[model samples]
Target: MKALRISAMALLGALLALTSFFVGMGVGVRQVPVPKAIPAATPTPVPTPETGVDFSVFWEAWGILEREFYGEIPPAEERMYSAIRGVISSLGDPYTSFLDPKQASVARQDITGSFEGIGAIVDMKEGKLVIVEVIEGQPAEKAGLKSGDIILKVDDKPIENMTLLEAVLLIRGPKGTPVKLTVYREGLEEPFEVTIIRQRIEIPTLSYKMLDGKIAYIKLREFNEIASEKLKEALRELIPQKPVGIILDLRGNPGGLLSVAVEVASQFVDKSPILIERTKSGQEKLFKAVPGGLATDPSIPLVVLVNGASASASEIVAGAIRDHGRGILLGEKTFGKGSVQQPFTLKDGSELRVTTARWFTPSGTAIHGKGLTPDIEVKAGEGEKDVQLEKAVEYILGLRREGKSDVCEGCGKQP
Candidate 1:
């Protein structure tokens, strides 16, 4: 059918792209420019009923199979499904996936608040499964899995030629089940195996406390599916304390869902736009602050916390506040991952995550590989609070006093 042909063509295009990537035959990072816009995904078309000689060509091989096959003939449905799978596998984008009924159900469960697994965000780096971010308090983190860790094997299965998703399926399983991961650490000369028992992991979204009883300290862990809800709950509890200022921490938060980030930013901005999603056709979708969204007043002094690991949606929120002059950023440089990844499902229930567009700040500054510079830079230290947080608190309180006697002299800056 025409629709089937078109679908196959599109799928072929994707396959060609991925094949080039794997062959190391594609353009380099600098040569392959980031998408300036987001292209809308094409709608899948319906196959048409075959007729006449065309119909004969369609099942020519199937008819031969039934007539000449020595063993019991296979069902037509199974053959059809196999063809569909073959087409999907040709695409080569592991994140772009197709899920059958069973796999789809498992994927839904995995996206829920908790799942049994070694908590880690994985990506294909140099043809190997690389840990992007290990969830805090999870098995991987507790087992000393760090960002950029290279996983060479799981049990006896070497990860060579396997995609990131394939590695994930091999590693994650029922709670209390054991898995051995062979990894190559940066400073270690030998590859070591870490045996870990999988457990149900509930990702923590927000961590908060009152710093010096006045500055509300909030560290947003990540913008997962439920992050915005958790953020509102955290703020509801903290706002009543009447803190002089708030430190919105986004250090090491490898961003989750974009919607979660938009919702979280809405809480602090009332009458201004938060971000704009620009599509390939130059269509811009503006995410604006909801009416009366005074969850935090603009007049209330504010400081944003960021570091090397703050990326994607974290950068979005930080860039929004910094560009709008809603708050001062305080920390070292951030992880510059400003592209948006849109997940596509393939026929085999795997996912193809493709970077669709480069995100820009409100002021039109690109944050890709060029993170936000802090208004006040602070180097972190052991046995002391993060120097960034300390500076933000001191800055807010000092500004409140406006040149009165210093309250905390050890902070270097006046008060």
Candidate 2:
């Protein structure tokens, strides 16, 4: 991993999936988007006696556990929360789950783009906590954390069986304080230790660099609240340079707010019905791009880089670009997460993200389990070289186009 020493101001952050790596839902994908397009779904009505369900069995078990348990009983609140999680889990939809107040707070703060903690994104894979993305020049990179490194311990404490939120809280601390991570890298003989000093980290919505030939390359991390404002700032600076082409990198982005998705995409696409949404009741709505976009000229060269991790809001942007024929997508297949989530604040300051609808491309393709197929399918391996990016540069520079279809056919969708 290339070490980056970030100079931007930091915050006290306990990095989760999208915010907290950030949250696991619209509350952050890696949507970490609240509603910018569709209205938030109304909270589910409380269970009424008319509903045919038995609570006697649940009460009986609870009573028995309280009376005859072998060990000390958990607090009533924890037990109630666990029951709620169990009920939610029974629905079998991974995206629809509950978060307690603390997790909810982290999810909300992530959109602000400022936080404190080691600057890294992590997720659970096969029950192991693994580092996914390390921000350039962040404490995690400075302390030598790498993508795919498995975190076995934090502060010498085993993280086994802890939830993602629990682990993140344990790893996070006050700024300038040190948190020790015991990591197991692939080629290492034994787990090693790395100590990272926490800082106030303000995660950038996007970072841009001008490539050779004045091609503007932007790497967008998430569609947080400040995303549009930041992108406008970046575009204002880059567009004045009259760049020949643009490359948008959304490789590991997990997605954020849906409204923000449309807003960010508006910069590139000017047409209506950038996306479609379908509720379980069959009602449908077509979302259009808002007015006053920064870069709506389709003639400008553009390529979006996506991988399996590019999901939700990111997918919405990529799909819109393809369906509108505004740009071509490069790299691997995207993470197919087309369902729409609505955030409902519970009474306890906790949050519940429930899947309310499924979204589609303007062309009417529903990418739930099946991701969008890139126009140029190029896969890369871990190394010093980025083959997909190189290919994009070649495409923009007119270097390689021998019998390949770079343009989308019959893809323009009208509302």
Candidate 3:
């Protein structure tokens, strides 16, 4: 019996040796197959009364968890997270996501002027990992990352099939961490590699310049900490010039920090409701502009410039001004992103950025996907002088010549 056992062990050892020899010669191990592209399908809209769930998978997952998990398993909230991910994945919209606490916290910090990263806004456009916007003073901006740069790889990993959020997760890391980005730029001959050190980026929220002598052009990049204060500083410096009009540009801006947006919007609107939140329980919360919140020269004719990139807080400010008849919106339609995201922190130091509520303009117009249209439609191409701003200035000057006052006729206020 001992001899038979010895013989079996010897045979197994021989087999292992033979397998190792063949593997060293590159003959035994199977090569990993390259992944093929899966075309994106159009998302079927989930019906209203939005539990926003797929019950079959949810039940199956729950059953599996209840049966297989060791110890006490997890709480209901954790189970719901798995269910929510399954539901959101079913929608097939890569951009629309259900972030758990960890992911939510990260996303919130990304917007809140915290966290260290390459500092590029990326989104899945036509199934490609594309750069939406590069934050000024970020490592990406310093590396000459452009607005339409397609990200092909992170470090050495091919990101062709990865979603934007996933790519961001892979790219973002601790401060001073190095990341190599392989990007395909439009005018570049070949794909290039950029090695960047991650750092905290304070997104530029306000850009100002004296335009054509009589107009101050302030391009709001995004709503962030001290955005209102910065804007006020710009106004303070510009008002002395006694500009005929103020052109507030919101082109190519993805909104951020709702409170800042509200403060900025209040600078244009008088004592009136700027936005209203409609909750799931049919409750409405009104965000009204406080009295004496307008700029010192609120009656100084104003024009807001918007385009396809203008979204969220940008829409809030634009919508408020338009609804209040306080300013004329002059660019193309704004990027209508009106839903509010709430960030929940997780034990793993991650976050979930969940869309909690939808917001509407004072006139009850929801600007989610269907963006705000300009009062004076002015089409302008890239690297071109925004004709919208020009038209707005023309309109304001025309009104001034016609002896029409700058006050809101509908609101009967000075702003």
Candidate with top TM-score is: 2
Instruction: Give one digit per residue, the lDDT tens place, for model 2 in 188-270.
Output: 89999988898877786688989998888998887767777878888899988987778999887767667778888888889
User: On a 0 to 1 TM-score scale, where does candidate 1 land against the true structure?
Assistant: 0.67
Candidate with better TM-score, 2 vs 3: 2
TM-score per model over all chains: 0.67, 0.85, 0.71
TM-score of predicted structure 3: 0.71
Error of 2 at 379 (Å): 1.6
What ranking of all candidate models by lDDT puts the best one first? 2, 3, 1
Candidate 2 residue-wise lDDT at 275: 83
User: What are the per-residue Cα lDDT tens digits for candidate 1 across 191-300?
Assistant: 98998888776655577888884888888765545667777787888888877778898765655556666677777765355666565567665666655444557556
lDDT of each: 0.58, 0.71, 0.60
lDDT measured at residue 303 in model 2 versus the true structure, 0 to 100 = 87
What are the per-residue Cα lDDT tens digits for candidate 3 across 1-415?
0000000000000000000000000000111222232343333444335666554564566778799988897787787666557777786533345556544444444333345577665555565666656665668779898878887888988878654455566677677888898989998799999888887655555779887647778987655455678888888798788877778887765665566667788877774687887766788978778555635355678778888767677777888888777777777887666666443434444343344567788888988668888777789756757566677677777767786645544432212
Model 3: lDDT to the true structure: 0.60
Better of 1 and 2 by lDDT: 2
TM-score of 2: 0.85
